[model samples]
Target: MGEPVARIMVVDDNEMNIRVLEALLSGRGYTVSTAHDGEEALEKIQEEIPDLMLLDAMMPRVDGFAVLKKLKENPKTRLIPVVMLTALSDLDSNVKAVELGADDFLTKPFNKALLLARVRSLLHVKFLLDELESVDEIIAMTARIVEAKDEYTEGHVERVTAFALGLGQAAGLNEWSMRNLRRGALLHDLGKIAVPDDVLNKPGKLDKEEWDHILRHPEVGASILKGLKSLASVVDIVLHHHEKLDGSGYPDGLKGDEITIESRIMAIADIYDALTTKRSYKEGMSKETALRILQEEGQEGKLDERLVNIFSQLVERGEFESLGDRIPNLFNIPPPPPR
Candidate 1:
């Protein structure tokens, strides 16, 4: 099939400007929509999001800047590429538009070729970004399938992701690191799919050979994700999440600072989720017990001391309570009976 037609929205109070953009874009086989002002643009956007927006900076009432601000604030519309239309002398407004997340700019009177070029470029970028989002969805779905294989620990990926995100937020990680941390946490166990179902679901303790197979999961998972460029940021977290600070952990046995902070944060969440989650042979431990085990591991140089401490503090402050409530099935595992 041929490439999909790009939808372009031109937002300008001037009828002439809108008509010019419409003529320029529509002739090039683009689907064109127009709004006379920012308010109309916003309403049209809410009704049906456009692939790209051509916003005129100087409009009556709600101008381009106001529209850009609203667009950037709304997560659903935030990623739609916006090219601000400005007058030749409106450098300040252009700068403001950039600050407000405008993707590109076009100065009036519009050059037909330049307008088409900018439109094509922004549409290409938006197409690539949309493709990347689809890739993310595929990865997330794969993670879910891996989780589905183990009925005993359903929602494990989600819980781990939330815990990792909480720890990452508390540590003041940058947006990039936080995003990778989330993807890493969700797909951390993706390699487990390679393990035999009998080995994975065994009610008895794993024998040495079975344990060896289990230990290969991190490497296997990392290998599976290594092919995707988009997942490069989080690949280490999947691979090294099992590695310990003291070099006692498996796969590459990365020690101390050799492991990425993303992996370190994921390790704490992974271990905590594993401890609190019930299995066929063992019941779920209480949150207190899980925290105690984590503290002990930190003391013994197994996990990152600082991250563990931060996670403990977050737990104490009930920061994860709301997340737990959202995924009640994961956190609702009953406590084991007293001896």
Candidate 2:
């Protein structure tokens, strides 16, 4: 396919600024749109997502800072790169914009070449981000498909991701790590795609052969995700999530310190989601019952005690309840700790 045209949204209260930027962008083969202020920009965002947003720092009603805050808060529009265009070239404004997630900044007495260069650079970054987001959406959609196919796991993938990210944060993982934790949770069961439908959908307990087939999913998923470099980290999580702290887990029976923190966090999130979410073979266990299970696993050295304890705290405080509501397929309650 030919290089796609980027959609650019110019948000500025100054009529002259909007016209100048709009013409500049349209001339560069970009699809241009305009909003006079932050409020109008928000309205336009709901109608169409732009590849890049050029926002004026000062505007009546809703300012650029307010708009940036709202955009960063939303998952849907957060990935779109924002460039702050304003006469304010002071250090304070620059720092504030960067902190609020503006991808670039430009002074009002702008240089045409510099503006074009910055726009092109930001657009390229946005293209990479879009590609990455598409891959993540595909992985998430695949997980949902698998959950739909397995009658017992309507919301399993989403819940696990919520729990995993919470645990990741509680363990002092950075924002990037927390995001990676969610990716791991989403792809944790991808290998199950290779399992036979009969085996996957069976309502009864798994026999030896079925168990064997189930155990292969980690490796199968790893292989599948490894083929896509974009999902390399997720592949490790899929392959090693089952490994326990005491060497009791399968697929390699990795034990204790051998497991990565990412894998350990995924293990707890996966098991907790599995227990609280209903399956064809069994109804969802109560919240209390799930927490007990996690605690027991921690005590038995199957899971990281510190992470499990933090997860349990989050459950006790109802932090996870809201997440369960946002994501489908899991029980509508917080995950319980391993007994």
Candidate 3:
């Protein structure tokens, strides 16, 4: 089969320039679309995201720099490769475009050959990136399937993710750490899928062998995720979330410094959600009781003390109160204590 035709959006205020680019790109077997201004381009993007965007540097209402800034800030539009069409002498605009995440630049008084070449290169990169993103989506979908297994545990992952994010923000984690924490928290319980449903949903105390199977879930979850290269940073959190600082916890029994900060943060969130959330085996504990348990755990060196303190404060301030409403089965739970 022949190569697939790429969809390219050309955003220029000047009618002549738009026609020139549309004709040039269309002749090369690309499916071309045009927007007269940045606002129009963004609107069209919302309707259908193009594979590439050729944005004009200077427009009356919203300039190319402003549009690029918005695109880079939005997760949905951020990955669409953009080439800024600017005047040849506009070095400042060129620098600004790079800062705003423009993938490439095409100076005005365009060269058909250079434009086509840049378009080809950027589209190739976009195709590869879309492939990687597709893999990540598949992994996330698997996690959702695991969540769907136990009705009692519905929304458990969502609550943990929300609480972990609040804790990470309170602890002043950087963007990369925050991202890892979110992904790790969402998939932390993935290993539970390997446990038999009868064991997982048992309303009574677990026997020794049954408990061992439960304990192996962390390793099971890590094993499932370790095969994906994009999730490497998150595997440690999944594997060691149950570990304690005193080396008394399960799995690898990792001690202080041996555990990643992301794992440590996730541990606190996991415990809090597990305690405060109701299940078939036990009723949900009060927020005060859960906080007290977390405090005791931190004091005993099982969890990070500083992170626990931050999380407690956030809870007291009702930072995560709204999160309960977002989850499917958590709306009936009582609100946390106010500060």
The number of clashing residue pairs in each candidate reads 0, 19, 0
lDDT of 3 by residue, 130-197 (tens): 66656555656676888888677878887887888788888888877876777787789999999999
Report the lDDT of model 3 for residue 140: 63
Q: Write the per-residue lDDT of candidate 2 for residues 1-339, one digit (tens) a residue.
A: 755899999999999988998888898899999999999999999999999999999999899999999999987788889999868678898789999999988887899899889989888877876666566667667877776766667667777777887788888986555556677787788888889988988887889999899899999988887778666666778899999999999799997777889999999988988888777667889989999999999998888999999999988999887774476543222221111
Per-candidate RMSD, Å:
6.2, 5.6, 5.4
Best by TM-score: 1
C-alpha lDDT of all candidate models, in order: 0.85, 0.83, 0.85
Model 3 steric clash pairs = none
Q: What is the C-alpha RMSD, rounded to one decimal, of candidate 2? A: 5.6
TM-score list, all predictions: 0.91, 0.75, 0.87
Q: How many pairs of residues in model 1 come into backbone collision?
A: 0
Model 1 global lDDT (CA atoms, 0 to 1): 0.85
Which parts of model 3 have CA positions greater than 4 angstroms off? 1-5, 38-47, 59-62, 73-76, 328-339
Residue 154, candidate 3: C-alpha displacement in angstroms: 2.4
Cα misplacement distance, residue 211 of candidate 2 (Å): 2.2
How far is 79's C-alpha from truth in model 2 (Å)?
4.6
